[model samples]
Target: MFINYVKGLLIGSANIIPGVSGGTLALMLGIYHKIVYSSANLIRLKKVKEDTIFLTMLSLGILTSVTILAKIFKSYILDGSTRETYLNMLFIGLTTGIIFKLKQEIKTRNNNNNNSKKITKYFLFLIGFFTTLSLLLLRTYNISLDISEYQNKKSIKYHIVIATSGIIGGCAMILPGISGSLILLSIGTYKEIINIISQLNIIPCTIFGISTIIGTGITILIIEKTINKHFAKFLYLSIGLILGSILQMLFTITKLNVKPTLTLKISSGILFITGIYINRILESTKK
Candidate 1:
């Protein structure tokens, strides 16, 4: 039970990163399905021992990370445009690693079957591409809610709006390929929550946090059920989405500084290559 909670905490922290998802972390940790099942089966707790304990610890970790890191993350988003670009690079590296792993797994599993269809692979790739593209384009809208100003004028209407945004954000978080922060940005609540956190305003932040918990629970329930029903197609789509997200992030902040330094280029290549190498290492360990 303690192990489950601890792991959940770590996963929660990973999910809070702009380009990552709790689901992705859960998948990496090999608990994706189990976590999903646990959440979706919340009502059937009578048959599941210690489910609440696991969930509580996990939730605590997530809460701590979001409150603490939200401000830091927001700083990157708002301050000196370079932050998002750097973040995008890191996520691109991470997603590239995941995509390589996914491809290797698919190949290994299908190697013995000559009758296996190849078109399905391409089909899944396209799904991921389009989904990722949609998120990238969304950045242009500048749509976001600025909730931090509520400290001076806390109203029921503000709470309702924040809660609604949280629900939508929660849905984006559950989907393997979608960026939750980006989704929040689209709905207009991301900036508000960031402001609230940045200013260290507790009341409104707490309200928004509670709403996120409720929203996350409900959203995960539905997504998990759907993934379980269509595992392969969903997996392929997820890979595509992750890949697309990486590309989108790359393009969103694409900039060519005057006279590209050889050092910068070398360092980036190393980071990307190192990321690829890490993927290979993780894969070999799985065997």
Candidate 2:
């Protein structure tokens, strides 16, 4: 149980940091498979006693770690535009590193009987999820959240946006190559989410928690089966997903009040490369 708590701390912390992968962190901890299987069966009321205990401890650690980190980030880390720019560049580099990791994995899994059946299944997934995807993109072109609007009780549209963010976050939490925090950043809700958690805003947290659970339950089965039966297609899908998310992250930040100073350019170049290198090393490593 103590170890579970520790695992949760690490994984949950990873979940918040841009470019880090909680699922990959879980994989490194050698707990990914069990967590997945247990989560799946737990929903079915199988091993309720054991799984609940395990998940409860893990969840607590995750919650504790994230809350603490959120507070720290809110208080000290993300203070200035220049600092934010540097951090974002590093994150972008790290996130880009996942593409290399995926490149290798996709090539490795390419030997699997590749065919169009898997493509068709994914087509259906796309069709079924068309509306949800639409909701996510609604803010893609303009990624900032206007809290003032929500305060007026006229932020139903933004409310819907946050709710959709929860769903995407939930699904990303379970997937390996893609992480929930990264997706949230791409969708323009990362900082708002951190602030919300730090401030203990009940409404958004509730919406996020509920949607995360729902998204996990809804997508896990489909995702598991797809990976099992169509490994190559899943890799391709993952690549596309990461690519799109990264593009969005960069795009949204461009809309921010960024000043392209010399220091900014140099830091951006160096840190971005450093992030990619660090990510590549970590992603290639195993326990």
Best by TM-score: 1
How many collisions between residues are there in candidate 2? Answer: 0
What is the RMSD of candidate 1? 3.9
Lowest-scoring 10 consecutive residues by lDDT in candidate 2?
A: 127-136
- Residue 242 lDDT (model 2): 54
The TM-score values for the models, in the order shown, are 0.78, 0.68
Most lDDT-accurate candidate: 2
Regions of candidate 2 where Cα sits further than 4 Å from its true position? 1-34, 46-54, 75-80, 112-137, 143-168, 175-196, 201-208, 283-287
Task: Evaluate model 2: give its lDDT.
Answer: 0.69
Q: What does candidate 1's lDDT look like per residue over 1-287, in tens digits? A: 55666666655555555555566655554566766677777755543656666667777776666667777766555343644445555556656777766666666655433334456656877977787677666655554455555554468888788777667777667666677766676566666767776687787777767777677788777767667665655667778887766765565546323234686556566666775675566556656
